[model samples]
Target: MSRHDFYENIRNSTRLNHFANLVNLAAIDGDIKPIEEKLLKRFSRKFDVSEENYEKILENPASFPVHAINLKTQRLEFLFDLLRIVYVDNKMDEAEEFLIRKYAVGLGFSEEQALVVINKSKKLFENNFSFDFYQHFIESDED
Candidate 1:
């Protein structure tokens, strides 16, 4: 394959892994709810995952390994996507919370940082949680 095609494949693989993570989170509560499925479909589209691959991921998300995102912005966006799935039903359960924390670590956050992000996200998601606001909150801690 050409260099461009090679890089594209790697990027697509990473996106597939990320999408699998979302699928796993959605199914963590035993069955995937209708609302959760809707959100998952939307995410698949955003991630550029094909319908065939989407179904395959849903069949067994655990098969995909967690790929650590390099960019801070990407990591936060990853966390935000997880939070979106957790809150899609208008509630956050223990399983969802636990999975999200694990995912945060996989996305390169420390355990403590995961807790902080999850706790703060729970509150922010309940209000008007925009990515801009969430990014500001996280970055503000560095100053």
Candidate 2:
């Protein structure tokens, strides 16, 4: 494959893995609720996750590796996407919150910063914030 295609594949894999991790959080209560399943299907289509890959991920999500995103803005965007996943079911449990915090830290935020971001993200969800809002907010913060 071409270099760009190669990197794109890797990025797609990472995103799929991350989404799988979020789905795992929803299933932590020993079952995936209907809402959670709907969100999973939505995310799978958004991420271009194939049926074969979906089955693989469902079979064993924890086995997937975490891949790093290099850019700060991209990392923030990634965290926001994870928050969206968490909020999709309209029920953010303690387990989901814990997993999000852990993923945020893994993405390079401090524990305190992660919590702050999570809170901000929750508000964004409540306020029906769009991707443009997130982009503008991040840009304004950099100024």
Candidate 3:
């Protein structure tokens, strides 16, 4: 794929979410277990990403470090939104935690910055308790 296509693919796929990639990675413990295979397949199918790209992602974990940095530069709300989706059901496994740390460090964020990011995610969870409420607030709020 061209460099542009590679970036576009990452941007369009759920794998763009570092947290989601972490969750997916957590599901597989080095081997391609059946359930993990199923989950990956489902994610690929849903995102219209080809198996080749998925394989590339698995083979090279740091290929998207720049993308992770870009995500970090975004507003805290966007970051927390991603974290919330990844940590849905209120649990983050070891693999997910590992990925988050790796990406944060790669983005050149200090330990304090990383902690602040996690704290921001927690605050997001507290501030936006429901979809309807968030929708109402987002629509009404100027700030």
Q: How many collisions per candidate?
A: 0, 0, 0
lDDT preference between candidates 1 and 2, better one: 1
When summed lDDT is taken over every stretch of 10 residues in candidate 2, the lowest stretch is 134-143
Which pairs clash in model 1?
none
lDDT for each residue of candidate 1 in 9-50, tens digit (9 for 90 to 100): 976876777779878766756788887787678767767789
Give the poorly placed runs of model 1, Cα more than 4 Å off: 1-19, 22-55, 58-63
Worst 10 residues of 1 by lDDT: 81-90
Total colliding residue pairs, candidate 3: 0
Query: What is the per-residue lDDT of model 2 for residues 51-135, given as tens digits with 9 covering 90 to 100?
Result: 8887777676657534556777887888877666556656566655676776777677778877877766665676567777875
TM-scores vs. true structure, each candidate: 0.59, 0.56, 0.45
- Global lDDT scores for all candidate models: 0.76, 0.69, 0.50
lDDT of 3 by residue, 1-143 (tens): 99999987766664445534543443434555665555555545444556777677656644444333454334333444455554554555554444455445445566766655554444445433754444344334233
Give the Cα error of residue 89 in candidate 3, in Å.
3.3
What are the runs in model 2 whose C-alpha is more than 4 Å off?
1-15, 21-55, 58-63, 135-143
User: What is the TM-score of candidate 1?
Assistant: 0.59
Candidates arranged by lDDT, highest first: 1, 2, 3
* Ten-residue region with minimum lDDT total, candidate 3: 134-143
Number of the candidate with higher TM-score, 2 or 3: 2
